[model samples]
Target: MEPEMLQRKIIHVDMDAFYASVEQMDNPLLKGKPIAVGGSEARGVVSAASYEARKFGVRSAMSGYMARKLCPELIFVRPRFDRYKEISNKIRKIFHEYTDLVEPLSLDEAYLDVTENKKGNPSATLIAQEIRKRIFEEVGLTASAGISVNKFVAKIASDYNKPNGQKTVNPDEVEAFMEGLDVKKFYGVGKVTAERMYQLGIFTGADLKSKSIEYLEQHFGNSGRSFYNLSRGISYSKVKPNRTLKSVGAERTFNVNLSSEIFMEERLENIAKELERRLQKSKIAGKTVTLKIKYSDFTLQTRSKTLPYFIADKSLIFEAAKELLYQEKMKESVRLLGISLHNLNTEMKKSVVVQLKFDF
Candidate 1:
């Protein structure tokens, strides 16, 4: 990570309304209205809601009933993942034209490592604008771009302008941006963390940075390290390409809530080991495993384990997950549990598609 060699140039591109936008682009009648793509029936929640719907407080994963209540004009439509994936592939191709150092965050968003890009662009800011413009012109869809010295800032910058726009945050501007940004606007800091920060008088990055590292660590633990560095506009993570999701999963909610951590741990461990054995049996390895815990109060928290290498061994999986159970504070009782495999691969339990994109 030499400073001169790293001259860090990063861009985070996020498609506007993604699934809903693709729907609008493909269908003429759906434009300029509050639309959502999800289960059309009342039993479902919106998977991707349009900006118009967002104006009314309707959001993704929110119940259809609630969405309808928020926006009386909301129109629910069934999802077409196939179509969305097709569009995603197209956008990915566009990204490759600029640099192979592209990391797709989702079908809708990605991080581009353009420190030494093939496009020969001097500024990552211009590259982002050009990419967003090309997507609009060629794909008939709007995308927003964020430009900064690192992925963290770029990811947030892209969202500042909303749909059909782009923004840049240079190194010198980082201080002003962070100082003005709300604690809630941070990527991983959730509602609970935001409230805690507010109570601690950390309403903005300036407020956040004023707190000493020891104070932050005492209050926020491991996440505080990230907060301190981020408040200084620094990030050390790399942008790996064509990342494969390690473990596939399924989780169901119980009518009853588990009152004890031991019961909850066992329930979660079983699910993890079951999935782990299946993956090992298939000869796949994963580096990161995540635990999704939902409490009786309907509040959710997640913890993750990233090993030195991919491993699908049941014992290893269960042990790491069990350790995570005690690593976090869980005051509320749990109602649901889920496990997912991430940062997976084939070489050493590698990604199923890493080779396909790696050689590109």
Candidate 2:
């Protein structure tokens, strides 16, 4: 390990139930109530749910019907993304006051490298507390923070105490802390990965560390090295600022499935227009166009085509999407339709060729 790695101080800050909290803050009547911000109860999915709703197994990304079944008294509210983005800007301003090395994960979460901060505070824990305090006082929202020597440990530590709390793990304690942690709690270990780990008798970081790199690679492929490094409390990934945009896409689930070819074409055109608008707003064009379809029975299918030139026009995107749609044979009624553009021209630069002439 590099000596400077031990000296780095990183902090991860995550808002507490961001959208739901914003709703509750805007309307006092929503306080202490089980509420969700999403589509109507008759259709769509939950974007965010208040803490009260979570107690009854209601969670974000869950279908509205299932959430209602879990909590009969759940109140559904439409999302206000513009308002959330406004508040997020205020929080980001607070982060800038302390450190310039801020990497925003989303509107509600970000990572900060305060190893050398503008405040010259010398203590990452104190910096995190001050940031959280300022967010509450200025933005009227609470945030949780985690502090450590690296991004991985810091991100995990931030979630240790959620909902307006902070936790810090010093460099010396990182190894011990990781060894005792549950494998399921690791950042990238999702439900399927956790189940696989359990079957391998790797229930904790200590269990994962016991296996050799080759053994792990044989079982888990490329991610085995990541698991091995994280189990030993070693990470070198830096907090990237101004991360590049990867893809622009839009998707919508219909309240009723569409089986007619003409109706599907209309829906595809709308989806393509939305994607074109987003691509234009981002000032990006892509060579690849992808069409995604979700059947009523929950089956998903995707088709993609790469064009010779980049395109961002609505008509062009719609035409490409229409071609891909007809190429596939429909097996079931589609419940959702989506269009996406990939291989974006966000950072493409013109190449320069130099010629050298030698004189004798």
Candidate 3:
């Protein structure tokens, strides 16, 4: 391990069941009850479930019907993204008070590097506790925190004692701690990857560490290097304060499936407008336009076109999306329509800047 890697201090902060908790906090009647925030049981997925619902095996991304089956008394509420965003902004303000090296993974989770924080706090653990304390005191919500030398270990530690808890992994204990961890618990190791690892006789971090980098690369491709380094408690990725935007997109699921091409065009227009709005707000443009369609049967199809130049205008985006929509034949009545812009100009500019530095 590099000496510089050990010198860094990182903390991962995650809100505890953010959406469901917000619902409960706003309405006292929901306290101590199992609740899910999402669409109705008929044609919706669970966006978030309270810890009480999780005990009954309900989880985010699960079908609402299945969630209800798991926990019969589960209450459902529509998502209030606007409210969530408002609260997220407040939390971000709190994070900025401690360190500008804060990288937001989502509205409810972020990674902060406090090696040289504004407060000059030497103890990352104390900083994490303080941050969590302020979040609860000011936001009326609980947060879990993980403190460690690097982001990967810190992120995993955050989940160890969740829901208003904090965990810290000292630098000396990182190796032993990682070796004892289950392969499924490793960051980036999803269910499918874990199953594959199990078939390969790699069930834990220790088992993963036993495999050669070449062997892992042969089996997992580019992700093999990440698995190799992460299992050994090595991650050099920094806490990027202004992470580059990769893509801009917007989608909407309709109450009823629309079979008519005209109605689909109207939906596409609205989705394109939303995508353009997001791109403009971010001050970014992209060359690729993708059209996503989800059928009533849950099947999804996408068509994309890469333009000659980057564009953020609504009309241009809609024109490209409209062309992609017409390029493909509809298989079923569509329940959802979406538009996305990719290959962002910001990234292109970054590449240009890097090349210029190399030339200089």
Candidate 4:
């Protein structure tokens, strides 16, 4: 039999309705009310919704019309990204106090490895609790956390008791916990993937564990090996303190649909300028240029080209996007246009595996 692997202490911390919560905090008059952070126009999309709004079916990425229809009392507020970033910085400062191994996933969520933290605290559960308490006291924000042996389980457990709560999956409890989990609850398994798994008689982790590796590979391709290991509560992903940028992009949703190629080219020029500004701000360049198109019917399509060398100039980017735009004929009126540069010069390298040893 193979020897057992050492367990590492990992924690996932997630803020509760970060943008909406900040708005409420900044203006107490909006407290305990249904509010969404985004435009309230016909073509607007909700960026975030408060818990009160979520009860009325208001959610992020949902249309403003649908959100207002579901919650007649919904109040739409413009997003304040600068203020949100200021608060996010304060929260990240708190995380650094306990461990320098913090890996931020976004402005509101992060994964932390506390196997050898600064405070010398052995119990990750206590560390998580302390961190959450500090955020509430210091930042005036309620945060939830999950503590477990690995990143995958910790991320899932973080959602169990949300809105200012925490949960811990003990090392011995990982297997049973994963077995009883719904397939959709596994990270990266979307609705379409879950439905496909259900069609294959794989509804839960237990069902997934019953399938052979070959069978899973034949159906899931590269993701098959990932699912096979994750179902058994095994994952090797580590928390990198410095995660590299993968792509730089900018997109605009039009207030009016345009069918003419002239209008699209104009929009692409503006998008390419914005994309170039972002790339320059980060001193980053990429070899791949992609054009994203969303038709009036809500259908989406993307076209990409990889050049021999990286380019970050607006003129070059715009030229590349123009080539992609005329590469195929338009199917319908276009409502959205986007330009993205991928294969960045700062792509993240493969993680170095480190054997973690814990006395307890």
- lDDT of each model, Cα atoms only? 0.80, 0.88, 0.88, 0.91
Winner on lDDT between 1 and 2 is: 2
lDDT, candidate 4, 1-360, per-residue tens: 121454788899999999999999999989999999997658889999999999999999999999999999999999998899999999999999998888899999999989888898988998899999999999999999988888999999999998899999987788899999999998778999999999999998999988889999999998999999899888878888889888899999889999999989999999999998899989999999999999999999999999999999999999999999999899999989999999989956555445465542
RMSD of each candidate relative to the true structure: 7.6, 7.3, 5.0, 2.0
Query: Model 4 lDDT vs. the true structure?
Result: 0.91
Residue pairs in collision within model 1: 247-341, 285-349, 345-349, 345-350, 345-351, 346-349, 346-350, 346-351
- In candidate 2, which residue pairs get closer than 3 Å at backbone N, Cα or C atoms, i.e. clash? none
Residue-level lDDT tens digits of model 3 in 104-146 = 9999999998877799777889999999999999999999999
Q: What would the TM-scores of all predictions be? A: 0.74, 0.94, 0.91, 0.94
* Clashing residue pairs in candidate 4 (N, C-alpha, C atoms within 3 angstroms): none
Global local distance difference test of model 2: 0.88
Q: What would the per-residue lDDT of candidate 1 be over residues 1-360, giving only the tens digit for each residue?
A: 453343377889999999998888888899999998886535566889999889999899897879999888888888897799899999999999998888898899999887777877777778888898899888889999888777888888998898888888877787789888998988679999999999999999999889888999999999998898778777767677756554565354555687777887778767877787668666677778777888878798889989997767777777777788888678787777787777767542222211111100
* Candidate that beats the other on lDDT, 2 or 4, i.e. the better one: 4
